[model samples]
Target: MMLFCDISLAARIERAETRLIADSSDASRARRGDTLGFALPYAGGVASFAEPDSPLNKVAGLGFEGVPSPADVDRVERAYAACGAPIQVELSTLADPAVGDLLTGRGYRLVSFENVLGRTLDGFQGEPPPPGVQVRRSGDEEFGPWVDLVVDAFGHADNQGVPSHEDFPRAVVENAIRDMAATGAWRLLALRDGAFAGGASMRVTDGIAQLTGAATAPEHRRRGVQSALLSARLAAAASAGCDLAVVTTQPGSKSQQNAHRQGFSLLYTRAVLVRTA
Candidate 1:
């Protein structure tokens, strides 16, 4: 019975993921900036290129509803090639099983598997932030610090191995924040003693909200910063009429454990497949 329930929830999560990527792509295209994203007719997925080196450029939402044919694979390659970027696809095991064989036959290699977890928001409750800690929505002027904190927390690195907080261009962060906000997403920042400690973002679609971009300063680890942020986001999502909240994380990682403690359950696992230009 539990297995059956898991399978049913996985299907729901897969549908949610497809919608998530499509909505995100639409938002990116609407911005009409350096980033270019669109729905791929052949692959039944969304393709996006945020930057020549940024990892956000890739294809997703594939194989959720149906399998991609050999011609679909060819079209994907052509689409990315036209943009001069390497081809990458994120596929869920819950998607068409043939998707794996098709991509592998086409020279795509497995990259990583990310676990999708979710929880219902109805009657959800969150604890208040610890004393001396405050959480709030970030403003435009706070983008720099928010980005800095996120980079520091995640240790983000670019293609050339340049550290994000020190070497990444500030304009990129500004544009990303602006694009997120323009796409109906909210960026949250956590502060301790008036100093930036952590940040996260949430986007809602069809009563579902996805929590992403979560990060915390190294010094702030285990200080309840993430818990506070999670609670705040869930409350905000509920207020926005969202009935479900989803997040992705490395399996068995602290993030996953945290989500579980908050009543989230595993939905499905997805692997990223890549083919270099």
Candidate 2:
């Protein structure tokens, strides 16, 4: 299938992602009782502060509205300033070109880039898992174990190709997983012969299925755990009436490789620009 990363499509995905970030901020506030953990609308997108040192402390969907005015950038910086965190602006390459100029003029420097991959889910029913692998929805009864396994897997996963730009601690990752589920993400678990092997998550909005993340335990590598989890999430999202499924991965990462094998194509790249406060 053919997919184009036109401005309109980029805007739609950006908007959805921005909204999810904003909702996650709200969830963080409720969970931690921190008043600064909130979201503010700016330049037709959102500037969210999830907590100190969080990657979510950034502005999303910036140029979709237009190149943000100097005042708009100042306002976002001030918001992040109050919380003592850097202002991360994830600008889509498909956004107005002028947006990059404005941000650089204000001292935001290129930090890293992440690729968004997408696939059409129209009439797509996912294939069954490989032998001895099982994928199923995670619920309250399994939340603790599921989270533990996810955290452990992420802590021990092998790194190759472009090194990761961000390294999150276990405590922060735990908080993030809980916040994601609180803000509408559906968690799934993969089992190898009835033993927990991996975990993943998905969030859908306006027919777009966001494959939030997935990770397999070090011992479970090459057992089809990640593929099973991805297929199960895709099937679930398609059945939920979603027409598209998207996942964001670091450049040259194994995650991107897996996504490519599953028919996901590059949709766009988000240029990460940061202004340290």
Candidate 3:
């Protein structure tokens, strides 16, 4: 059965994503120093600065809890400016029109859009992936390898799709993956013909299974590695008591296509608005 996604569902996913940003703050602080890793409360969400060029650098879950106060908005802008980073706000389209109006009035330009896809975990039994592809949780000794493979997979852009607004260096992606693991994400690996072919990760927040990220190495692409990894995560999530599983993908990208094939639905779209510093 398809799950009905109302504004309430969006709020839950947004809040869960924002909290992951807080975890990124902790991971950044551990990787760098106390001077960095700031997750400031803004409006009803958080303005997180895990690192200057971090994918986690953004204001999320805003305006859902409440309107963005002028004082809070000013403070968030100043904080990002101090860090020498652009202020990116991931605003749900379901948000009040006033929120977008306020952001545009402050000179934030729409940079891109990402779709939030989801499926309810009601006795979902994922189908077996294509032959030669196997999925399993990465053991502690395998975590380092997991990061390496996933980041490498991330580096090879999809041949076609709406491009991502931001791309970080390999080192930056590695750090972010480490930070995500520090925040309690379970690393999962996909093996093709008994070799390390790809990796992915997930974190459960408030009974919502947040599919943090997943990538298949270039050599292993088009072999159903990603789909297999996703199925493994869904099964694990359902077993862990999660009611909903969500993944954010570039609009019309291969990832979104794979998700759609695996029974996920488009729940909402997050408009990426930016104020460059």
Q: Which numbered prediction scores highest in TM-score against the true structure?
A: 3
lDDT for position 161 in model 1: 21
Question: What is the alpha-carbon lDDT of model 3 when measured against the actual structure?
Answer: 0.89
Q: Please give the range of 10 consecutive residues that has the lowest summed lDDT in model 3.
A: 28-37
Clashes of each: 0, 0, 0
Global lDDT of each model?
Answer: 0.71, 0.87, 0.89
RMSD, one per candidate, in order:
4.6, 1.2, 1.1
Reference-based lDDT, residue 197, model 2: 93
RMSD of 2: 1.2
For candidate 2, write residues 153-251 as lDDT tens digits.
Answer: 878756865776678778888887788888889999999988999999999988899998899999888888898899899999999999899999989
Q: In candidate 3, what are the lDDT values of residues 9-68, reduced to their tens digit?
A: 888898898899887777888877666658998877889888768888888887687788
Q: What's the ranking of the predictions by TM-score, best on top?
A: 3, 2, 1
Clashing pairs in 2: none
| TM-score per candidate | 0.82, 0.97, 0.97
